[model samples]
Target chain A: MLLCLLGSYFFYGWWDWRFMTLILFSTILDYSIGLKLTDTEAPKTRKRLLLSSVIINLGILGFFKYFNFFIDSFREMLLTVGVEASMSELNIILPVGISFYTFQSMSYTIDLYRKKIPVERDFLRFATYISFFPQLVAGPIVRAKDFLPQLQRTITFDWNRFNSGLSLVLWGFFKKVVVADSLAPFVDLCFEAPETFSSIHLMLGVIFYSFQIYCDFSGYSDIAIGLARILGFDFPENFKTPYFSKNFSEFWTRWHITLSSWLRDYLYISLGGNRHGTFFTYRNLMITMLLGGLWHGASWVFVFWGFLHGMYLVVQRLIEQPFRSLMTKLRVPTILSAAMSIAVVYFFTCFAWIFFRAPDFEIASTVITRIASLEGFHPSTIISKFMALKGILLIGVLLIIELTNFRIHYIPLLVRKPAFRLAAFALILWAIAFFGTFGANAFIYFQF
Target chain B: MKQQIFSRVGWAVLFVFVVFIGDRAGGWLCQQIVKGSGFRYSRMYTDKAKCDILLLGNSRGLGFYQPTIEEITGKKTFNLSYNGMTMDLGKVLVEDYLERYPAPERLVIDVTMCDRSSPEILASFVPYIADSDRLKGLIRDTSYNVAAATSVSHLYRYNSEIFQRALYYSNGKSDNEWLLDRAMSTSTLKHTENQKYRIDARFIKELKATIEYAESKGTEVELVMTPYYPPFAKVVRGLDIFHEDIERGTGRRVRDYSYAIEDPSCFGDFQHLNKKGSKLYMQQLKADGVL
Candidate 1:
């Protein structure tokens, strides 16, 4: 994963050769320390060591990623005091995927400290597991127990696993190359200068972006899992048809499944969970989600994104009893109720994604303001510029793919007849080959 | 377990075979329909053999370089640009065109940074890398000495009926249809505004290859940096290091037309030129005797 991150940074022209070397040296030192620390059975000593490691990892992240953010915030606070104090800002280059793998690395010591898993004695295996290139950048956040065991075992090739893996990889490529990348042009056209676009275009852009992000990140996850499967390792599924999710709770369960679950297991549950009564439970939920949002980036947009979801969960919890009763009284059909819930959740999620997608709060506010305005209602302009017909068709196709099949695991079943399956596979491949954007567009989550 | 695995493998292979056959059949069917129409396969727009000039680049090339250049110059010309072509792949296209047609007297290669410098250019050009047989047929069909009847059969097979329908449905319009519509459209053709001319190291490499190839073939290659809007052009000019590197590497005179026309009225967007701007820009090029 470190290699992939470094490779991506180099490929993207975002970092210099020196930065890559620094990252490599840091990674090696961190890995060695991790291995050495794990070898001992001193619990109290391990606790101190783990705390120090957390400090060091977070210290690196804080300096590189969040120092500027904090400095600016502090500067703003100082301006309010009428005593002007400003510091010359250091332009720190954030190492790609530091937040992701930092948490991943922390999970190892945390797990070790909890006695949930044994410390890996083999330094190479331990390092490889942590920096396993496939899931290293964006993660399934492999547990030490789950991943370490697989690494320790002798890898034997399985044909079914290989076929399944190949199919997944192909599917991911299709989603990313064909659908996600195709949507990018329209999304970019609309969002480039949002002030010029109508509410309709702005709304359409957001919708396109929501799908683009899904296809981008989930596509990465699919490729990662597929690659791991090819190498005789099983990584967890990180997405589960998230768009079809019936509620915010269900959406969390579905979208970025690994990260959500990790937050649930490590952070939420650790913060007294729902055990400390309703008030504390709400507080815990907010805290977990706010941090989860911050985990995405140092930006306030991410914080707001996390806050919105956190709000949804809290509201859902508050209204659960009454809403359940109301549904029962209304005699709402199960499917209809589920659909309504999903729609509501999806709408809110899409709104929040604007913040996630926008460069900063100013752009986010502009988008919100434009969406609020009823001006620029020219349907013709929207139709011509946005390729409204094609955009709708693409969205329709994506929905059908998601809703009809919901489960990606069932894709193999669609090809019951070998001939039919082969034809479908070929068509998909040809489509991707001819029409797909196989350009060097990076996955969206690579920034985090 | 082994038996199960073998069975699965057998099925997968069979599936792949069926798909290939289906695709070929689909492609063949599409060829038949397009061939039946009176459309000439090579010059769906103009006579290939009669053309003296070719405009080649990506979409920016397509949208900017008006095919009327041929009429204006009293020379038959073709804009052979596909939407997203890079200089590296443009080499193959130039080679392919030369293989069939007599080398055009002049070739206007749009040196857009997005086209030349983007690493993603290869992916964009993958679709256009036609197979050897298809390419040979294209060359033969476009040749003047080829009798009408001999070319007809070759064109017929190349234009697959099923593929044509699929393309029409997917694209919602044919390429010929789009070309016709563009010709009739009242909307002004926009050239790049805020044209930044940064002759980076990468740009120099591509420029050398293009220039060397063109020079060898007795075709003069004029490195024209199409005008972009102000700030964008400023950004490009600001890259002193990149400019220095290009000058050091190529030893070629890099023309900067970005700010040559200062009137904002000539620009439609930050990077594209308005119709008026294009005329003025073309006239300036003519005055400079670069065309």
Candidate 2:
């Protein structure tokens, strides 16, 4: 994992060489602390060491990620005071995947101290478990309990698994190159410079961006999983037809599955979960989700994003009886109800993504204001340029595919019929190779 | 276990065979349609050796250069420009044309700074020559055309509809029809201006290679910077350092026609020429003995 991170750091030119040295230092410290925590058999000493590790890791994360944000807010407060002061704006480069791996390592030590899982005897395997290349940069945030066992076993090659993995990788490449990258130009044109575009264009850009991000991140996860599968490992599924989710709760269950489940088991449940009472349960849910949002980045936009999801869950809980009664009164079909719930969830998610996609709060506000204005109603140009007919057809195709066989398991089955499967593969490859807009764009979540 | 393994292997092999056959059939069908059509430019440069002159560059080259240079010089000519083509492509196109056709008597290249400097564009041509089938399959499949259809913002802002219409109308044409359209289109040609002059070493190197290839073939090479609007023209004109760098890198003289004549009425847009402007520009080129 260390070697791979170093290699990726060099390959992608993501950060300066100094950052790589900092990462090495941090890793060595983490290892020594992990060893010391597991060295003792006494429950009190082990708990103390584990607690110290958590504090140290969280302290490092909070300082590097949130120090500037907090300082700026303080500076604003200081301006009202008689003494005017200014601090240099620290241009700190947050280490890639620090939030993810720190949580992962902390979970390991916490689990060991609690006697939930045994400490790994082999340090190399333990490190590998923490920094597995497939999920190192952007992750499923593999848990020690889940991933460590897989590392302990010797790997063997399987042809069936190899073919399935190869297919998945190719599928991921097509989704990224053909669907996501192609959408990027229009999305960037609208989002990066929204002032020049109309409200309609802004809306379309957001819609395209929503799809672009989904395909880009999920496509990356698929490739990662496929790669690991080829190497005789089983990483957990990260996405599961998230767009087709019926509600916000379901969406959380489906999208970024590993992160969602991790937060649920480790954070939400630990914070009194639903055990403390209804009001406390709501508080726990809100706090856990808001922190999860902050975990994405040290910005207010992420806070809003998390808060929106938390709001959704809270509202759902609050109106559970009323919503059920309304559904019953409407005589809405099961499918219709599901569709409406999905649409509402999707709309709210898209609204939140505006914050995720925006450069800052000001721009996000501008987008909302502009979208509300609906200033120019020029449909002809958009319809003509976007080839309205073909665009609709493509969307129809995607929708059908998503609706019919949204599960990953179906992908392998669909490809089992040799002739049709091969033809589909060829077509997808040709489309990606010829139609893909070749740009130097990494996956959107690479920043996270 | 052995049988299970054998079955999986058999299935994989069958899959590959099916794909290979499908791609070949698809290519043959597209070729047949293209050949049997009344398309004007499709078959004109199908074999390069027969052509007398060749024009190379990106969309600017395609949209600006008049193939009438062949008629004016009483030689067969073809524009080998592809849309969004880069300097790297300019190099490959030249090499490919020379290999396929006799060295032309003259070669005209349209130069752009952005296209020249982009590494992505440079990397595109690597697979074209190295993996011929991969490229051939891409073009044959018309996936770009499909993508162009689905992309709304690309169409409205970029005016790709004009190109698409032209492509559609040219469908199903014979070689004779193509030549006739070429002749008819030449008279109404316009000259446009070049904007955003940015230069890279790779573009300069490619331009130098094109010049060398032309000299080797006993052909004359003229590097033309087409006209642009006044403001953009000023920008291009201000690229003296970039121009000097190109000259130093290429070891060749490049003609600057960006400011040769600036009449606002001649422009269709900021950088493109009207029909009258193109004819006037061509006349100027003829007078300068650069045609």
Candidate 3:
């Protein structure tokens, strides 16, 4: 565990050494707060302790990540109102993994204050859990309650776990470099000059992005989880075939499982959840998602992405009964209905991604408006048939994996069968070498 | 448990073996087809005898009409440039050309922006690199040392998008033309000024060295600064500095035609000329007494 903490620190230090001090400060503060909260049963003391955790973690996060963003937005607002503002933006580097560790560490103190988890007196164990390098920067956001117990027990090397974990790591690498990187140039072309491209190309770009983000993020999660499994520390699965989800509610549960769960247990449930009347229920839902979106980055576009998803959820809920009855009334076969539902859910998810991806609402709205207003039967003239086919091939791989993953344990099973496993790895290797555009980009979610 | 572990390990070893074999086999086949392709540019890179009057640069040189230049100049001219070719790579090729064949009467060097850090020549002439020791040294200074070391057997050199290029060439997709000449509005072709426009020290050094090397072999080297749309005038930087540096480095005046053309129809894109544009530009060159 001591070795793990040092390794994690070293891993993080590589990106920016100065940020290590910030992580160290966060660790000590959270650990101290947890200890203090445990010693005092007084309501006010506990409340103050939790508030300190919130303020300190959130304060650090805000200053590093959102300070410049807020200042710039305010400057823009001032300009709009014809008021002169002269505050210059800072050259602050957002400490990598600041959001992930801050949230993970904050959860420990929160859980302790809520009396849900026992006070972890062992500082080494808690520190290790918070700073575990595999998921430190981009995470499954491992819960202290889940991880602390695992830390207590002696971990042994189980072959099944190791093989399964190895399989995931390989699969993750394939998804990231081969699939994501290959499609990136095309997506960048469309986004860089949204007006230059036809409406068909715009649609292709959005569809490509939905897969790109999922593959990019989920690929990171798979590697993290796989590495943890090999190390004999189990991190929860981060993604579970999100595009296969039938509704926005199901999509949330499947996509970024840890973040969604974190929001629900900590924020939404705390805000009276669904126990309250419909008004507050919807408000809580909106606020939870809005905050969740803001958690991704400091940008208003991300907040809008969250807003769109929130709206999707609220509307889906209102119409779930009607939609269900309508499905019944149509008398479509079960498989057919399920397919339609997944398609519908995936379409809305792709629509929201424009907001997530676009630099601002204007660009996002332009893309959407162009998509809607497009006339004539013009297919994409810019993208070649070969390039279009490649996109379809990559997206098809994900579809096959998810659809197959629903039934069989695809990655693990491939691992067990040596010939098939080796062949898969070889295929991934070839794809990466030949198809992947050189210059491996950093994981997309690492910024968050 | 022991049996299960042993069996699994056995298969893993076998898989690695197969992948190694596949990579080598695939690389060798791709290398052969690329060399054997009907594309004349690929042949010009290593060919000894085509050094009469050479045209050299990146895509700017590749896009130049060699047939028209030969007709006008009455000297054998072939474009020795490929897309993504760098100044240093051009220097190496020039030196190699002088070594293997008689020096050309004139080497018309298109002095395009020397900003790209990596040269695509490493991937383009993998087999030629393997066939010669001197050819291998050219890439060592660039970011190909690590790649070259691993690719000693020339397997890793074939790791890029070469298979597709080879397939396209073999399938006769290598059109002997550059610009699409597609009907695009001048509004669409309006160039945005790039913020970053600076030359690398190494690129300038090699470019100067290339001039000196050619001059030593009695080959007169002339530089032509490719024309861009007037709107992108602000984006093209360091031409004056580049000119001064060349004169200081090699004592030769660079014949800059950066503002030579202005008709919107004469341009195919922001920087490049279409076939029609190039034909007119060739006549402009003869008329202006610049060539």
Candidate 4:
């Protein structure tokens, strides 16, 4: 426990040693709060302690991540009314993984306040749980209930665990270095100057970006989960082919599952969830999603991305039944109906991703306008057909592997069968060498 | 625990063995595809592209437009140009061309190819590395990590935009028509407010070496700046400086056609000319005795 705790701190402290104090502060605060909640029979005191924990964790997160954001926004508001206000924005380097660790720390106190989980008394064990190196940065946001017990169990080196973890890590690296990074230059080029590119180029850029963010974030989660497994811990899956989701609700469930579930459990339910009337349920959903979006970054673009998704969910609820009935009446086969639904979900998701990726509203609007105009949509107009072709080939490879894995569950086979294990591992290593973009390219979620 | 450890180590060794076999097999297949490819570089290396004139540049060099040049001058032409090609790769290709084929009558180069150098583009020349020691050395010097990667996994040498083009032009597909076929979009024209390109001394040295080598082989080397849109040409910075540097470095007068084409319809983009533009430019080149 001490070794893991020190190693985790060292891993984080490597970036900025000053930020180590922040992690240490949060760990100590939560550890004390957890124990206090357990000892106190008084409900009031326990609630206050929990509140204190929440305040300090979020307080730290906000000051580092969103202080300049709020100030700049306020200044912008004042400017709109012709009341010129000058606000000095601080140059704050947001410590990497602050959001993930803060949420993970908060979940422990929140669950303890509800008496859903026992308070961990071991300081080192609790600290290790908070700072576990693998998921410490960009997380699956493992809860105390799920992770604390694993700390209690004996951590033996098992071959089965090693094999499965190795495969997962290999697959994750392929998605990240090969697929995501290969798409990055083209996406960056198009986004850097949307007006310069043809309509087909901008459209392809948006599509490539959607997959880039997906592969990037999910690839980190996979590596984190696999690393944890190799060390005798289990992390809940974070993504499940989210683009294949049939509806907005299903998309939320599939994409960033941990963070969405965290919001659903803590924020949405606390805001008088769907048990209330439809209007309030919609309100709760909007608030939760908007917060979720803001949770990603300090930008209004992220909030607008959240707003679009919130509207999608509300609008989908109102029309889904009628749409399904219409499809049934039209005698659409089940496969075709499913295909249509997936396409709709993916298309809207890609649309929202345009806002998420764009530097600001103007660039996003330019991209959308150019794509909508359909000027120079011919193949010959694409500036870099080589890049476009490479992106397509990589995406094709990813889809084939994912679709095949969906049917066969080859992950377990990669663990159980020697021949399968050898082939799969060797192929992944070869693919990484052949196609991987080798640079110190950090995972996209590392900023969050 | 001991048995599990041994089994794991045993599997790891077996994995390495399998990977080695697969890499060699995959690399051989790719080499065959490359040799059989009608892609310009493949044709150059395979001795299928001996001609009276050689054209070299980045994508801008493609404006030399082989089909029109062939028709106008009635001389066999081969373009040794690739998109985003750096000077390092350009020199290697030129030197290799000089070594493999009898000296062509003339070699036309777009001096703007020295504007930028890209390691990624140099790395893309990995598939042709086996054919030239100069290419292997240049790639090693510029991007040693990529060179190491190619050595580790031979299949990696074949993974690039260059190789992808090879596959596209494989099985006897002609690559003579490889040019940007689009006309200028209004947005592109609007966005081409002043732009500057820096010419590195090192790249100029590479260009000088290439020019000297072609000249030594009794090949008349003509360095020219391709035509840009008139509007774009008005605001372009550093071309006079680049021209001066190229002229001083190579001791050859660069035929300046940067503002030669006034018709915007001829331009594909600010940096390149469409087929119409290339045709018009070719006529100018012929009239000026630069063809």
Candidate 5:
């Protein structure tokens, strides 16, 4: 266990050696607090212990990640109000994996204080839980409850499990290198000069970005889960086909499943939840999502991205039953209705993605305004942008594969056929060499 | 359990082995296209080139380096223009060429208003600069980690367009960077007023140094503004300012050729000339004693 913790630290140190200290600091604080929680029965002492974990973990995250952002914004605000307040922005490098590890570490004390999980007596087991490298940096944000019990059980490597894990890793690589990276340069060009592009190119940029972020992030999650499986563990799925959701609420439930569930179980229900009627519920929803946005990055654009989502959820909540009834009254076929709903949800989600992608609110507004005030609708511009994205045909293939994935019940190998498994892997390997975009592009979610 | 694990591992290894053979085939195919004269640098560096009039600039330079110019001038010529080849890359190419090859008698730069360098352009040239310490350092100075990896990784090191040429378009051979006969525009082109051409001081300084270096080596350096479609040429931002800077910096007048052609069918895109346009351009060059 100690060796595993060392290996995890080494994996992190590969990026920057200095960041290992930050992870250690987080682990020690939470570990000590968790032990204190178990030792004490007094409510006041237990509350203080939990607060310490919250303050220390969140404090480190905010200081490293958000200090410069807030400082710059404040100075800009002061200037706008006819006051000169200028200070040099601090030179602070946000440690890679700081946010992910901190959140995973803090969950220990939070869950312990709530008496939802036992305080771990074995320090090595707890330490290993904190810095398990596979999902450490970009995570499914594995909980202590899910991971700790697995540590106690005997880990036996199943041959079938090994094949699936390896296969999952390959699929993740295909999604990331072939699909996401191929789309990145095109999407990047549009966002960099939103004004330069016509509305057609800008629309393609946003729509393409929706797929890029999905494939990029989900690809990372798949790799992480696959790696964990090789070590004899399992993680919950991070993404389903999120773009296929009929409404915003269903979208949340499908996308980033662990983070969504974490926010619901920890942030939402803890804040009096929906039990406190519509007004408070909306307030809570907004707060949770705004913080969720801030969790992504320290930018106001992210906060606004979260704000749009919060609004969508509230509006979706209001219209949920009515939309269902309206659909029933219309008596359109179920498949047609589903297709229509998916189209509506996907287009709106693409609208939200503009803000998510834009570096600032100004650019976001520019993209939105330009899109609304369309001068020319040229299919040629859209086609040219797709041509620039060399692997656009692969997107159609990927979509077909995704749509058929679960429904294809008679897939050879996966139901214990070794030859088919090998064939599948061989085919993917061939595809990777021929179609993959060759680059070591940093994962998008790694910024958080 | 151990036997099962070993078998799974064996299949994985076999899969990779097969893919490696496929990669070899793909790479060999790329070699065929990349070896063709359509890719200018590959031909220039490899073929015995009698370099007397050397053309250097960005994509504009490529379009302006008329194939007929060589015949008209009775001098062997090569176009060193690259797509998005900014003043940054241009300067390095200039120094690198002087160090390695015999200096040309005349260096004609097909000037554009703005030249912006990016890591993408720098990275694309990584494999080409494997033996040059100064070039490796220049790339590293732009971006430390990404440049370091880009220089080393086989997957990232190779240029893709040239690679694609070898695979799909090797058979379509051309003697120059562009197919002059193909008059085409892929999309509607327009000039937006808000799009200002921002100048980099470093690029200007580099341009000055490059001209000085060429002049020191007895190579006459001339900057030329190639012909643009009349409507587009009228609104090129900092067009006058760019000319003033080049002339003012180098103390050499920028020979003006822009807006020389009136025929609409001669133009390809907003900036470039079709074969018909090039024929007219060649006649003008000869009349002006530029050829």
Candidate 6:
């Protein structure tokens, strides 16, 4: 445990040695708070302890990640009205993984306060839990209840686990380096100058951006989970073919399963969840999603992305019964209705992704207007036909694998069949060589 | 435990063996597709394409419009141009052409292709490396890592737009219809200012070498600057510098026809002409006795 702790710190500190102090400070604060909460039985004192843990951890996170954002937003608001404000912005470097670890530490304190999990007395084990390197930077956000017990047992090397884990890691690398990175250049060009490209290109760019972000982020999660499993630790699956979801509610459950579950369990339920009336239920969902969006980055665009999703959920709930009745009246086939729902869900998801990807509202609007115009919308008018063809081919390959994997959980099965494992592994290796764009592009979620 | 360990090691060996055999087999299949392709490069290397007039440039070279040129001049024409064809690759391709077939009566080059060097596109020519030592040497000189990658994985050689085009034309289709056929967008015409082209010194040297080699092989080499959108042409920077550099470097008089086509409907974008514009420009080339 001590060696694992050292290695985790070393891995993180390699980015910036100075940030090690901040992580150490967080670890010590949580450890002390965990002990203090355990010793006290008074409800008020426990509440204060939990509140203090939340405050200090959030305070550090806010100072690093959001101080400039709030200040600049305030100045902009002041300027919009006729008042002049001169707020000095700090030149602060956001410590990498501050958001991930801070939430992780807060989860431990919250779970302890609720008497759901025992307070871990050993500092080394607690620290290792918070800073486990595989998911440390970009996370499945492994919870304390899921991980702490496993740390108590001595782990042995197991061949079955190793084979399955290796399969996951290889699939993750192919998604990241081949599919995501290859789509990036064409997407970047379209987003940089939406007016310069044809309508078809801009439309293709938005679609590519959706898959690019999905592959890039989920690819990281797969690697983290696989690496954890290889080390004899099990991390929960973070994604489950999210684009295949037929409704916004199902989409949320499948996409970023850890973060959404975290928000639902802790934030939504805390805000008088669905036990209250429908109006308050809607309010809680909005507040949770808006905060969830802000949690991703300190930008209004991200907040608006969350807002669109909140609206999607609310609107879906409002109209779902009527829509189902209409479909029944029209005698729509079940498969056709399912296909339509998936298409509508995917379209709205891609639409919201525009705001998430665009630098600001102006660029987002330009992309929308240009695509809507449908000028030069033919395939032949696409400027980068080579890139377009490549992107389509790679996306096709991804869909084929995903569709097959959906029906058959092949990664686990690979452990049982030597011939199948060998063939699949070799094919992936060949695809990587033939198709990957290798410039050591960082995983997209590292910023969060 | 001992048997389990041996089994695992044996499986690992079998994995490597499978990978090696699969890579070789896949590469061989791709090579066959490329050789049987009707793509321009494939045709040239296979000794199936020869011409009285040869056209070369980047995308702008596609403006040569072979069908119109052939109709007007009553001569056989083959275009050796691909989009983003750098001067270094151009020299290798043309030298390879001269070596394989009889020297053409005329070799027309659009000098604008010397604007930059594209090692990325050069690496895409790996599928044709077996036919030309010059191409292999040039690719090695430009990027040894990419050349090494081709050696490591034969399938990697066919991993490019060049290979995609080969697959596209592999079904016995005519390759001459490969031209941009769209009208210029209003947005492009409105925002044509501030565009600049910087000439790479290495590309300039390669252009000079190509001219010398073509002339020595008894082919008359004509260098010309293709037309840009008229408004874009008026405001474009570095054209005079590029034109002068080409003439000075090659010691050949370059006919400047950059303003030949003036219709707004003739352009697909600021730098390239649509089929309408290419046809118009080809007429001018024939009338000027350059075809």
Better of 1 and 3 by TM-score: 3
Which regions in candidate 1 have their CA more than 4 angstroms from the true location? A1-46, A80-86, A383-391, A407-409, A413-421, B1-291
lDDT string, candidate 3, A48-121, tens digits:
99999999999999999999989999999999999999999999888888889898998888899889999888
Q: How many pairs in model 2 have backbone atoms within 3 A of each other, for residues 3 or more apart or on separate chains, i.e. clashes?
A: 17
Model 5 pairs whose backbones collide: B33-B166
Per-residue accuracy of model 1 over A1-448 as CA lDDT, tens digit each: 3453444445423534555554454456556656656677787777777777778878887888889888887888899988688687798877766677677777777776677877676656666675676776677678777888987677777866776687778778877887788677777766566665667778888898898899888888988899889878888889888878777888898899888988998899989999989999999999999988988887888998899889989999988789878999999988888888878888999988988888887778777887778555445336234245455665687778777787454567765445555666776766564345534688878878
TM-score of predicted structure 3: 0.85
List candidate 5 segments past 4 Å from native. Answer: A75-83, A86-88, A156-158, A382-387, A406-417, A438-440, B1-13, B28-57, B65-82, B85-159, B163-223, B227-254, B258-291
**Residue pairs of candidate 3 with colliding backbone atoms:** none
lDDT of each: 0.65, 0.65, 0.76, 0.89, 0.75, 0.90
Residues B1-291 of candidate 1 have per-residue lDDT tens digits of 799879877876777666556556654554444333323223331223335666665654543335445435666655655545555556655665665666678777666642344433332221121333433443343332322322322222322222233344343332322221111111212222333444445545766776677667776666555665555465544433443454466676656576676666665444556566666676776677656
Q: DockQ of each candidate's interface versus the true one?
A: 0.09, 0.09, 0.25, 0.72, 0.18, 0.59
Q: How many residue pairs clash per model?
A: 27, 17, 0, 0, 1, 0
lDDT of 2 at B277: 60
Task: Return the candidate ranking by TM-score, descending.
Answer: 4, 6, 3, 5, 2, 1
lDDT of 6 by residue, A201-311 (tens): 999999999999999999999889988888889999899999999999999999999999989988999999888998999999999999988888989999999999999
- The list of candidate 2 runs beyond 4 A from truth reads A1-47, A63-86, A89-94, A276-279, A376-379, A383-397, A407-409, A414-439, B1-16, B27-291
Least accurate 10 contiguous residues by lDDT in model 6 chain A = A407-416
Query: TM-scores of the models, in the given order?
Result: 0.68, 0.69, 0.85, 0.96, 0.78, 0.94
lDDT for each residue of candidate 4 in A168-200, tens digit (9 for 90 to 100): 888888899999998998999888888888899
True lDDT of residue B157, candidate 4: 91
lDDT of 6 at A160: 79
Where does model 4 exceed 4 Å of error?
Answer: A407-411, B1-9
**For model 1, what share of native contacts is present?**
0.09
